[model samples]
Every structure is written in C-alpha cells, then in structure tokens.
Target: MTGSVRAAHTALALTNGLLIDGTGAEPIRAASVQVDSEGAITYAGPDSLAPEVASGTTTVNVGGNAILPGFFDCHVHFCLPGGAADIGLTMALPASLKVFQIAERMRTTLEAGVTSARDLMGVDVGFRMAIDAGVIAGPRLVLSVGIVSSTGGHGDMTQLSGINVLPYLQSPGCFPAVADGEDQVRAMTRRILQAGADVVKIAATGGVLTPTDRPDDVGMSVAEIRAVVEEARSRRGGVHVAAHAQGRRGIQNALDGGVDSIEHGYDLTTEQRAQMVDEGTFLVPTLSEVMGSLDPSAGPVALAKKALWQGKARTNFPAAVAAGVKIAAGTDAGAAPEHGHNLRELGLLVDNGLTSMQAIVAATRHSAELCQLDHLVGTLEAGKRADIVVSDGNPLSNIQLLGDPANILLVIKDGVVAKDRAGFLTDRPVSPR
Candidate 1:
C-alpha cells in the first residue's frame, strides 16, 4: 500500500525544502507541501505555516532540496524517434514500431521532470487514455492528434521516394494533414477534431526538417490559414491553433490568422516581437534543438537547417525578452539530438537573455499557459494538482543543474510517487489516477 495510490483518505507531506512556486515569486526557504491524497495541494508555503497532518501520513524530508511545480514542455512530437531527424531514415521506419516507441519515450520524459506535454503533432487520445489507465508511464498529454499543413509545407512529410506516404496518415499517430484551399483546410480541421485533438497545429511556414523547403518560405496561403484557425476556434472547449512559424512574415501571418502560439520564431523582427506582445501570442523557443543541431556531433542531415536557426534567433530572442514578449520553455523533443534533454531548454533560455528565475517560470507557469493548461497546472498554489518535483540542486543559482537527471531525486504526479531516486520511500507504485 506504500506507493500504490495511497488511499484518497491518506495524506503525503513534503517538508523541509525550498519552495519555488512557479509564479515568478522569490523562492521560499525551508518550506513544506501538504497533499491530501486525492492529490490536490492542501498547502504549499512556509514550513511553519503547514496545517497539522493526519496520523498515518507519509512524509519526505528533501534535505533542503528544491520543491517546485513539475515542468511542462509545450512543443514536442512524441510520435517521432530521437535522433531520427534524417528524412530518409525516418521515412523508411515502419509506423508499427514507432507507435510502441512513444510509450517508452513517455516514461523517459516523465522521469526527466516533465509531468505534462503538449504534443504539437501525431499523438492521439489513446496514449493519453493508456497513461491515465496505468497501462503506461509518461507525462500527462494534450494532443494535437496530427498537424494540418499546406501541400509542400513542414508537416507535409511526403517523401521524394515513390512510396505513397498518404497511407501513413491512416495510421494512428502519423505525420500530417495536407490541404490546398480553405475548403480542404476546414474539412481536415473537422476530421482532426473528431480524432480527439486538444489543439490544432498548422504549418504556417516551411521548416528546417522538410527537404527542398526553405525555413523562410511562407508556405500556407492566408485564406487557408484563416480557415484552420477559424474552424478550430469554432470547436467546443475553445480549441486553438498553434502555428509552426519561423520566418518574419510568416510569424506575422500566423498572428494575423489568430494562432494562439508561435513555435520557433527564428528570424523574428522588432516589429514582429512587438506585434506578438500586442497580440498576446506566446513564443516557444526550441533553443535546445536549434543549438544541438549546430553541434557537429548531431550528424550532417540533422544539421541541414543549422543556418536557418543559429544567427537571427540569438539576436531577436534577447530583444523579445527586453520587449516583454512572454517566453515559454519548449524543446522540440523526440527528433534527433533532443529527447530527455528538454530541461536543457531552461538553460538555453537563460543563455538567450533570461535570468534563472525567469527561465524557471518560463518552463513551468508560462509554458502551461502557452499550451492553454494554466488553470490546472503551472503554479503550486492550494487547490492545484499535486504534480511536483524535488531536485537535489538549487536550480536558481546554476540553471544547468536541472539538465542532469541525477539531481532530480523525486517525481510525483497526481499524489503518486512515480519516481523516487533518494529512497525516501521503499517503493514506487505509481498506480493510475
């Protein structure tokens, strides 16, 4: 009974720690967290202020470690394999194998302190259901199901090989939604909505990974762009569209089309940055993927779009920070050179002109807002879900400490101790929520 969904009547107390509530507030030293076993935070503040715990409570003393809201990655494609950034190798792989690989990657991601993820493309409700049903161990997922793209854009993983890639889409979690005009875009949006997508992701511009396509190319026409956003907006639960935009004009076009967030704004301008602020569009800088691609160790094909990202991003990123543009931490995980290294995105944000605390907030609360899950996750306030991480190192002073899994001693999701590196508890049951 130790870790097996300690009964909802049970209680868990995490005491003697520094609390970083993920609200951009100063960290509280020697704090405590009280979780009423249904997994809601009963208290999260100064240690002395904690309410009296009922008898039979399980307590964890983190030895002055840091307790914070579990991190979130707003942009990831869990359906893709790590180091499969190469087109031919990725295309040649069978969908059957890739499907199971997602479950394994999900477990790896959860242990990496990512309690939740917003899969920009190629994840359906089945995986989410499996995780919730205790059939798999992974992050809580908000799926886009599949990406909607204009014929030759980024999501158009249509290969040069004579093999018909269209059938690939019929598989559960495959590449894209290709459409030419507004009618086609609308039809595809409805189809994806019926697939149980929590959001709709569109390729507003061509991208680095797609062969023979320039990252700066404004791929999708405006009418089609507007149609996708319009259709998604009309859906129940207020489904929003996320645009994979990199070029300056394309970034503007995406905002103009009412995209909720812009992924990889590499060549953004000051005007575009200001517009993003005015329009309240969140920026998910997948800096880790960009910088990792530039490393010679990442392979040549993976490096094909190195120049597309490297230069302008470095300059405009800091400018966006200065202009008050909201930054969200997201590593384009699952593609080559990136996977469990999502925590590396925080350090990249710091290197790209954010302070340590700002970077932490970006990874936690801001990223949640970007994915439109702010109401439930993000800040560690009373009544919030008990998704928490206990880190061995103080992430505020040296942000890179989070990049090491060795420092992450505990990961608890929904009142269950999913991972316990310190042996504070004898077992890790992690029963379904």
Candidate 2:
C-alpha cells in the first residue's frame, strides 16, 4: 500500500474476517471494521453492507482471521515471580531493576493479547502511566496500590515464630496498610485514594499465601469494612473494592459492607451466593491459581494453598453460576502460575459450569463492566476504542488458542498496531519467540 493509503485520516477497513462483538451476539462472517483517527470505531458489519471507504484510507485483508474485543484480566500483580516468601528478594534489588522487571512483564502480557488489565494489589501506578503514555508497551492498567488488611491478616508481612519475630523483607507494594479500629480503616482508605489508586482492595479473610491464618477466619470486623467503604464513597470516587474472601462469614461481611466484587469466594455458602445475586455483586473466581496448585511441579507453598482452597473453589463456582450471580474472570496471576498465562482460567471456568460463550463473556465484557470501563474498551462497537485482537482460529470453539501467544496474529490498541505478525511497531524485538 502507498504511504498516503497506509496512514489516512478517514477509516482503516479490515475485511474478510469473522467478528465477535463481545455482546454475546452471534458471530458475523466476512465483516469489516472502520476506525477513525481518534481510535473510535465508526463502523462494523458485513463487507457488502460496510459504509463507503474514503479515497486514501487503508484496507487490510485479514484472510478470515477471528476478530474480537481483546481480553481483560481483572486481578493481577505486576511483580516479578518468586514465591510469596521470596518477595523479600525483590525488595533487595535496586529500584531501577524492579521497574525494568515490571516493564518486561507488562510487555509480555500485552503481546499475549490482553489489551487491558487491573492491578489488584500493587503500587505500580507510575508503571501503569508509562504504558499509557507510549513510553512502554503494555495493557491499559487500572491500578490499586497495596491492599488494606488487619494486623496478622492476609496482607500483613510480619513473621511469627513462637515469639514475635522482626519484620522480614517485603516488596514495596506487598506490605498491607494494617489498620485495626474503624477509624484507622477509614483513614487508610483515604490515604490509598490519595495515592492515585483506581480502586480499593481489602483482605476480608486470611489467604493461602499467609501460612498461619485459616482461609475461613474473618480478618476485619464488619464495622471496619463498612468504615472503609464509606470513606471510599465519600471521595465521590465510586471506588470499586475487591474482597479476598474465603470463609462463609467473611464473604457475607464483604457483601454487607458493599464490596463491588468478591475475589475468591472459596468455600462460599449457597445463602451467600443467593445474596450476591440479590446485591448485584460480581464474583471473580481465580480458578487458574487453584488448578496450578494441583501440578506436582508447583512450589510447596502453592501446592499447600491449592490443597487448602481448591475443593472450595470447585464446589462454589458452579453454585455461583447456577445462582445467576454475575461472574467476572480473574486469574490472580503472579500468585501461582505467574502472569501472561491468564487465558487458562477460561478452561477452569468451563469445567466448573459456564458454557464456552459464558466463560468468554466473563473474560471480556463482564470484566470490563466489573472494572467500570465498559464505556471505553469492552466491545467492538461504534464510538468505542479500537482495542481488537485477531487469532488464527475461532476462540469460541477452542479457547486454548488464547494460551498460545503465537496464535494471536494482530493486536491493535488505540488505533495503533501494537503487535503484528512481523513485530511490534516499536524498535523493541517481539517476545514469545
């Protein structure tokens, strides 16, 4: 194509492709997309019905690739891999090294076709902004600086060994803002919001990473959770909160406290699931982490975590689906199987109860709605950002193709070709060789 045709202002037509609009609508074959200079899609339909193209606009022939809205991961930690216990080693590295590691992971994730992600519990807002400004290549990140937890709770980094031990090393973002009373909780919530967090993350119960506490033990009192929620609302932020809930009581407490979504909900009761439906709360089941623990090659800590919570997750997932509770996909990457392998969560969701389409919806549209970004990038609709992905085969029939980055032939972000089969638009080499 000529330079004028390749970089035009009117529309870039992508013809001869199958389009899944991310609205749970039936797929349309031989479709074309018309994107404008601002990155908003202006048209999408059968090629025969497509609007007239401008003279100098480009037309790409996809050759029958499957085009769909890019995937969204709701819960992720951008930190480099090391077990929960080894996070201390990351803290010992220079700040520059840590930033480099985070950037590398971001590139890997973006190249995997995840165009957007939510940082569940990390203080990487600077890194998030860097990606957005084109200083780096990565998904659009909605970040939550470290989570808030009670002393000795899931987010707490204090080590216990018969006698109270000194504080061990912890990653900058790993240390929870430990609060006790309701007043303290409210203050901490305000502090996090001021730090540029897009949402609030709270540990309502103990977690698998913390060896001492049981997953069922409720960490924060009802008063404390409510206090934090009220504080978040007072800022006019609509600050969504995700609770790391496991036990029945903890799940109930989080729901009653007005949490937007429940992270694990492992061991959740039938009554709790019903209440979730009534309250319009979303359930984010990170099943990939649970399944990873079953692997013999997994670390002892990961295996222990899976052993403790897998049965609960497996039992409750189907129940939540049956109850009509809104389910959003999350993999809790970096906790077990590591980041960039988020698509495997779809298989676990399918094995649980959701149909193939339902599972895919959970990862795309539902996840965007959960993050309150549906207006921006969830679906391939008019006036929405052109964040699209093209895979070699139809993902609706075989979701496993998503797990192989090579299968993703094209990744377009904000009207720019971030990744093509040839390479990234930037000078940097393509990953996943």
Candidate 3:
C-alpha cells in the first residue's frame, strides 16, 4: 500500500503528513487526504478522523512531510520563456515553432506543482484545450488570450520604428489589441472576447519592459478603461477585468474603472491601498518580475526602468500587506522568472510581510478567488477537486522549500498523480477485474 502512487483508476489516500489547508489556519499534524475515483476529495483532516480506506485504494504515507492545496499563480506568461528582457522574442519565431516551446513551458509549470494559473497574456485557447484533452500537460489555465493597450502603451508590441507587426503574430485564439479612445477600446474589447478570452486584460499604466513608455506613465484614459469593463461585462457577464497597473495614477484609474485585480502595483499610496481594500480588489504583487528583471544583462533602457521601480516594491508591497489589500501570488513568469519558478512568489510574499501560511493562502485560495475558481479547487476541504502537493519539507518553517521543484515530492491534480518522487503508490498496473 505504501509505494509509488500511480495515476490510475483506484482511489488515493495520503496519510501521516502535516496538512496546511490553504485557509490561513494552523497546520494539522498527522493529517490524511482521501481522493475518490472521480477526483473529488472526500475527506481531509486529522488522520484519526479519516474514514477507513476500502480495498484497492492506494495509501500514501507522506512520512511527516507537508500536504497542501496545489499552488496557483494569478499572473504568468507561458508565451515568453523567462530570464530574458526581450518580451518580443516570439515576434520573430513562426507560430508553429513558438507553440511547441509554449507547450514545454506548460509541462515545466505542471511539474513545479502549480495546478492552476491565470495567464495574463500570450497563451491562446488551443493550449488550454490541449491540456484538457490530454494532448499536453499543464496547469488549469484561465486565459486573457491577449492584452488590451492604448496606442504606444505597454501591451503595444509595435516597434518604435512604427512598423506594427503584432497582427502578423496573432494566432487563432490570441489577439492583442491597441486602441486610442472609448469607441476603439470597446471595439478592441469585443475583439479580445471574440478571440476567446476568459478575462479581459487592460493596460492601465505603462510597464518597465516596454521601451516606448515609463512605468509611471498612465496608459489608458478613465473613459477608455471604463469602456473595456463595460464591454467585458456585456460580452461575458461574470468575466473578470485585470489591469496591468504599476504607478499610483494608473492604479487609481483602474480602481475607478472597476477592475477586479491590479497587476504589479508598484507605487501604491496609503489612500490607494485603502481604496483597493474598500473595493475588494485583489493585488498580484509580482515580486519575481522585479527580482528577475534586475539582471544587468537586460540593457540600460530596461535596467534603468527596472531600477526606477525596484526599491519601490520592497517598501510598497509590505505596506499593501499591512493595509489589508487582498493579495494573490503571481510571478509574471516569462517576463523575468521562468515558468517552473512560479512558487518563488510565495516566498517573496512571505518576505513582504505575509506569514508562511498567509503566503500559501495567497497562492492557493486568494488566487482561486481572483480567477473565480474557488468553488472547484483551492482548498483541501471535502468536495473540492483533489489538487494537492506534498512537499519533502515543511513550507511553514522554510517557505522557500516550495520554490524548489526537488522538494515537491508529490503533485496530484484531479485525483491523478501528476508527479511522485516518493514511492507512495505501487508501480503495478491496475488490473481490470
């Protein structure tokens, strides 16, 4: 019963581990998790309270490791491979070759124990369908498909030379749109939705990576941003709107325009944080983006822009935490940090004033809430999908342990063993009795 747990038809039971349920609660020692064949967790609590396992059920003894809900990254980019300053590397590559690299990044992300992620841009619906149909391996994705930026804004992939080659790179389900005014914003929003966006991403401010604009410069006008929100609600009533907001003015504009989440909130004032808390807006502090972009190799334009905002996150992030703004984990993978390094955000969250448990909650529960997927996953409670991770060490004691894939001993998604470094389930194939 105690061996390598196979991804099979039989039930799964993980026992003898410390469970952090992703609810900001204290960890329970000697916990057990029971996943039914349909991939729903039937029980998750202290081992003494776990029901008796039936015959043929694979029982995994975690050996006092930490059991947690599968992590989530609220912001990531599967299109751009991380560790580079060139956001437009995919611009030159043909779509055929680019897709294969994107698929590999998805697999790498899955192996890192991230079960779900919200892709802010560059991932198309084809990738999502492939993962769902078992054609590829990756996290459950909530895709924006592409970003919406104003002329010369951050999402504008156009070169300063004025040649707009972005349309050439548009695939079947990906469409990045740039508009100048309310009417254009509305039309572009419709185009993004028509291209199969689960969420609408609007650039409320400039970004560090874009050469055309400064991060503090406001990108979209208030009316233009409102137009996007209005169009998104009309197209998909429950669809979420996220803003790539870094500066204070843009953050205020996004909040005023009714954005659901703020990405890379670099220069937030106390009033803005209070406003965000009042509006129930989530903040995805992508510390990984800041940390990863610090590479001097990225060039002077990028390095100077990065330097402008680098010291700000260290001060602002902890203050946002103290001001009670809802936090979610987002690494901005592909922008700076690589895909598999998603969990590094959790440790950065800890360093930014969140406790280890709170950091886990930010990655798991808060992220799910931001993605509007909390009911299906995010926690270890019964009735939730059996998306879980068993780490070789306790993350509460050393949160950085979750950052390393080697320490992730097991990864289960929807009751199927995705990765198992430990021999918890038997290698024997399930017999068709």
Measured by lDDT, the strongest candidate is: 3
Q: How far in Å is the alpha carbon of 255 misplaced in model 3?
A: 0.5
Candidate 2 stretches with Cα past 4 Å from truth are 1-11, 82-85, 161-175, 294-305, 422-433
Q: Report the candidate with higher TM-score, 2 versus 3.
A: 3
Ranking by TM-score: 3, 1, 2
Better of 1 and 2 by lDDT: 1
Tens-place lDDT per residue, model 1, 1-433, is 1123222334789888889999999999889998886788889999898888978888877778899899998888786665644445655678777667778888878888889888888777889899988888888898888878887778776678645454443336444678888999899999999888888988888877666587788877778889998888888867878888988778878888888888988888888888889988888878876766454655576475676477778887889999999998888886544667678888899998999999999989998887777887888989988889988768998989898777777888877777777766654432211
Worst 10 residues of 2 by lDDT: 1-10
Q: Highest TM-score: which candidate? A: 3
Error of 1 at 218 (Å): 0.8
The Cα local distance difference test for each model comes to: 0.80, 0.77, 0.85
Which residue pairs in candidate 2 collide?
none
Each candidate structure's TM-score, on Cα atoms with residue i matched to residue i, is 0.92, 0.90, 0.94
- Work out how many backbone clashes candidate 3 has: 7
Measured by TM-score, how close is model 3 to the native structure? 0.94
- Output the better candidate (1/3) by lDDT: 3
Per-residue alpha-carbon lDDT of candidate 2 for residues 249-278, written as tens digits (9 for 90 to 100): 888899889999999888888888888899
- Choose 1 or 2, whichever is better by TM-score: 1
